[model samples]
Target: MTPLPVRIAGTGVHLPPDVVTNRRLAETLDTSDEWIVNRTGIRERRWLAPDLATSDMCVAAAHPALAAAGCAVRDVDAIVVATYTYDQPLPSTALIVKEALGAFRALTFDITQAACANGVQALFLGSLLVRTGAARRVLVIAADSASRVTDPEDRTTRVFFGDAAGAAVLTGATTPGTGLLGWDFGAELSYDVEIPAGGSRQPAGATTFADRRHYLKMNGRTVWDTATRCLPDSVLNATAKAGLTVDDVAHFFLHQANLNIVRAAMDKLGVPRDRAPITVDRLGNTGSAGVFTVLHKGFSEGTVRPGDAFVVSAIGAGFQWGTLCFRA
Candidate 1:
């Protein structure tokens, strides 16, 4: 299949006001700031208020992205929302965001279950729609309210997650070979990280809720092993497929899963750490919003420029990992 040329015109992010610091968690859990920082490299994270939902962040993020791209709500051809903790099960999260943004004319797509890698999945769809001429302007949003699902009392899971949303506007690139390029995606079935209930396999019920079955469960060591190994391998494979190497790329937007994981990928690739920016230190692991936040930072800071080669990569729950290469 022939690929279409699509470029990211703009990027944006929305972080809730409430900051959950390691010290704050230490208040409730038997952990210390130094311990959290040394292990996860996360000092603080954002948590959405009880009144707000993931869609609210998506709407907030969409406005800046649309403005940055010089496009309006009515002009957007599609809206792709990637999330796991949707507001509810009945109504689609994408539809909720579209209504809020007043982007009624756009088609909506919901990409749930990819967790941290949802952003890459949404990007693939956004690029496809633009390349096929099915949409001139595509709004891609990645958001997750891990605050809504994780066991709050469990320090192991709660300390590593935060709530936030990130968005990007994709449009056809005028320059040839300056859009979506090579990619690599792989997955292995594993319950290393997962939400155990609320689905058909374990239906939501009084027993499920009472037993605390409807919550996020994770195997931290398994996640660390899978991520450290796959993130770099995926990036290398994707870059090589694009006829480029880590040295040839100017910037790398990697999943904000862990600061150490990012460093490991850079070390494995033998590239300077500055080539990949860090946000996990401040925002923690924002699930699907992780990679997009890095992308937003790079674009807003003017770190990514025309003719620059860049790559976005992520590993999510379900042991899924992927990388997308682009020529900026």
Candidate 2:
């Protein structure tokens, strides 16, 4: 039997009220707002309060998403929380969110390692659960507390990330030829972006703490090269897989990693600049939440119309990248 198409029933987002502007960052760092903006195009980003964790963001995001979907907590059959900056490793962040949301009947999942691409992966899993009849409604939350992982004084990594969470409710699309239609997911192993310690390979200890090994490390140049190439290609591949062309896609929701990267990908695709919605300038790089932020914006503001085709894509620390083409 042909599987049903997964529809994004509703979406919501939670950005901490605490805003960190580039000028504020310059108050402590050696760099200025001009330099940061010229390079990253990030003028400001939200920071979770010192007291909160990743799960807090997830739970906050889930409320409105479930409400928007008209789904009760008990009706959510599965909860997928995607974040590398989990509250901790032992109890599982998904379970924490599920418990907080009072979703006792939901099966919880954590996509803890995908970094920025975690949102795409979570949405993929949500689609599968609905398409396979394993779930009627799935709540997928992508969030990250990047401030907790970056060195407080490192200008390189600290300036580029923010804390945020975005939630989506997924179900089978009753309309034929709508919902998740085609996808292209691919990865190439690379450690150019990683946290050097805090796993079984190197347990958390005084030495790792002193060296800041738990903090995320990234090669900006490598990220630039890889994202510029892989993202556009993946979009083309996925669009083609759906038997559509670039022109057929009404909106492009690429990972909100960098404004320049987003522009470059669109340039490579020969797509116009306005076709993609961007939230990185105000939100910075919210890791897994980036895609959701943009998606929520497009959706809430009525940009994503019915019968229109759209493409969502991203890349992560595992060098994993994917594109999902959908009709709504």
lDDT per residue, candidate 2, 1-328, as tens digits?
2334888888999999999999999999989999999999999999999988999999999999888889899999999999999998889999999999999999989997879999999999989999888899999999999999988888989999999999999998988889887898899999999998999898999999999898889999999999999999999999888989999999999999999999999999999989999999999999999999988998889999999999889998879998889999
In angstroms, how far off is 152's CA in candidate 2?
Answer: 1.3
> What does candidate 1 score on TM?
0.98
* lDDT of the structure predicted as candidate 1: 0.92
lDDT of candidate 2 at residue 70, scale 0 to 100: 91
Model 2: lDDT to the true structure: 0.92
Q: Which ten residues in a row have the lowest lDDT in candidate 2?
A: 1-10
Question: Candidate 1 residues 1-328, lDDT tens each?
Answer: 2335889999999999999999999998989999999999999999999999999999999999999999989999999999999999969999999899899899999999888899999999899899888999999999999999989788889899999999999999989768877888999999979888888999999999988888899999999899989999999999888888899999999999989889988898999999999999999999999999999999999989999999999999998889999999
**Model 1, which residues run further than 4 Å from truth?**
1-3
User: Candidate 1: how many backbone clashes?
Assistant: 0
For candidate 1, what's the RMSD? 1.0
